[model samples]
Target: MGTAGLKALLHRVRYEVLPAKSTEDKVLAHVPRDVVVTVTASPVKGLEPTLDLTARLAAHGYRVVPHVPARLLRDDRHLKEVAGRLREAGVDDVFVPAGDADPPAGGFEGALPVLRRLSELGSPFARVGVTGYPESHPLIHDDVTIQAMWDKRAYATYIVSNLCFDPRVLGEWLARIRRRDVALPVHVGVAGPVQRTKLLAMATRIGVGESTRFLAKHPAWFARFAAPGGYAPERLLTRTQEALTAPSAGVAGLHVFTFNQIAETERWRRALLDRLGG
Candidate 1:
């Protein structure tokens, strides 16, 4: 892709934020209204925080997508209420992941069920998103994750890849999905400008069960973030520019995992856009 195409991608990107006490203020203060803000559903806090933030952001006239993890919900009635609430709040998009909740809060164990339920409920949301694992899921086999997407293809409108640092892994995963005919437009997930200390602190609060298992699976996470001058998001983007922007890739846009570093993330995005001449 040329710089123009890359610039357009950077200009229209989604910022994923964890639901925290001061997150709303930071988002209102730093993020542009045109950019989509997604609220994450924390296993510890459950779905209320995610819904609340989504409603607040939507009220402010920002397009917001809330993470509705299947494991966090209780049942179909609860899903209907949640859908009704989102509709009333004016949200049109949602991201559904299997989630980190252990033993689940109810019968919903994976995203497919909730996704199917959403469709059964007349597909209330305009855009429904499912998780994509470019890297191997810590617990689930690689084939299983790919198969999960195929299973979810009927219900989900798009796929948001999880955080990944390697371009090769992302390319290979994208290839596999395309081969299997899972053609949903992908919003590639990348980490935003993050400070090592804050990243570590926030990881703990996301959910103990998932965090612990995830840390064990990717032991080098700390070292990568702790490296000299910290992790540079641009380097990854630069390397994957062509693949991501290719017509055949079916990439929708970028999904930045801000990790609640909203202000820093906004700053980094602006600076990167400037460098890209966006």
Candidate 2:
């Protein structure tokens, strides 16, 4: 991609933040109101933290998209309550994922049922997002994952890819999805500038550890992130530029996983923007 196209993608980038104690303050201090912010729902903390932080961020004038994972909800009643809360807060966008919750809280075991419930509730939000895996999921078969996307096409407005380090894999996945006829605009997920140590520490704090199921299910991610040498997000972006800018890619923008390193992420983004001529 040309510098102009790269800059445009960066400009449309959105940050995904964990709903932790200090997340609200860090986002308020470092993130511009013009930038979109997506709050994550933690299985450990449940959906309360996600909803609370989203309401607070929306109040501050940021376009907030909260993760409303199916596993966290109890039933249709819970879904309605969640929707009502977001509507009261003026939130119009949400990202729904199957989530890591084992023995799902209620009837919803995956995103599709919750999506159907949302439509039954008259599609409360303007934009609803579902997860897409560029690489094979450790637990789910690749065929099954893509078929879920096909099943969800009628309900979801967009797709957000899971974080994948390999640009070639990302590009290939984009092409494959187009071939499959799932045409929703995609927000390619990428990690922000994060220290491996900091990332591991955050994971532990959030109840993920070496022996945790989270790490076990994402062994590939662990190996890549913990490998020798620093991880430069810009390099990944540069390598993936052509695929993203391609006409058939249908890429909407980027969804940066900050791991709550808000200041560092924002600084890195701005410096990159400046280096690319603002």
Candidate 3:
């Protein structure tokens, strides 16, 4: 990384997880002490587990940002309880995304309702993150997604872009966000150096529809990865560097989707950073 690039990487790094059994220890063991680590709330495991994991991670001195999926919350009462738990745990940051639950859990179907409630309760968090889709979501339209982001900006401190393989798409999206004057700093999402076979196997065991939706958005990437010689994350990171170098780019940092390949991911990150003199 260049001098500016190194500074950006240091400031923007974040690790993600699904709050699986033993994930807390796994995350703590492999993730770098300096990077902000985020535990995600999956539909299967629910938010409580992730919240508890966040508290434990916070106690251990890591800056933990847990995902608060909107659909998982039952109502305002539940939201207040969740916020209180986080505040007591010294967690001052959260990532709010419209969850993937089939039926609406309560009155809130999307992030705006939950975000509004959090704001109303006088949330103690210093940073509240909202999701951004650089690629098209399977269900929601692009216009609705953009408008939802705009609507939630008042309650959000930052925007974490959903996974996108093409850096050019990210660059264009950043330009559009700036053009629209949506100034919240962006944390670009990238998957770590995971083997193609491993990724595919994991995806199958998880859910094929979800995996298909992901692959649909990045056909070129899937095709490339499925080809001979397999895939490497360096291609993605190199493109990321190019995108971040653009003048006045609001790219704040990186949110790496480690997919529980924590050790290898960190190793790849360190090696790349060293190569860039970071």
State the TM-score for model 3: 0.90
Q: Model 1 over residues 15-87: C-alpha lDDT tens digits?
A: 9887778989999999999999988886877898889989999999999999899999998889999999999
Q: Per-residue lDDT for 27-121 in model 2, tens only?
A: 99999988899988867778988899999999999999999989989988899999999999999999999988877888899999999988988
Question: Clash totals for all models, in order?
Answer: 0, 0, 2
lDDT of each prediction vs. the true structure?
0.85, 0.86, 0.77
Error of 2 at 134 (Å): 0.2
Work out the TM-score per prediction. 0.95, 0.95, 0.90
> Against the correct fold, how does model 1 do in TM-score?
0.95
Best-fitting candidate, scored by lDDT: 2
Q: Write down the worst ten-residue block by lDDT for model 1.
A: 206-215
Query: Which ten-residue region of model 2 has the weakest summed lDDT?
Result: 207-216
Evaluate model 2: give its TM-score: 0.95
In candidate 1, which residue ranges exceed 4 Å CA deviation? 206-217
Candidate 3 global CA lDDT score: 0.77
Better of 1 and 3 by lDDT: 1
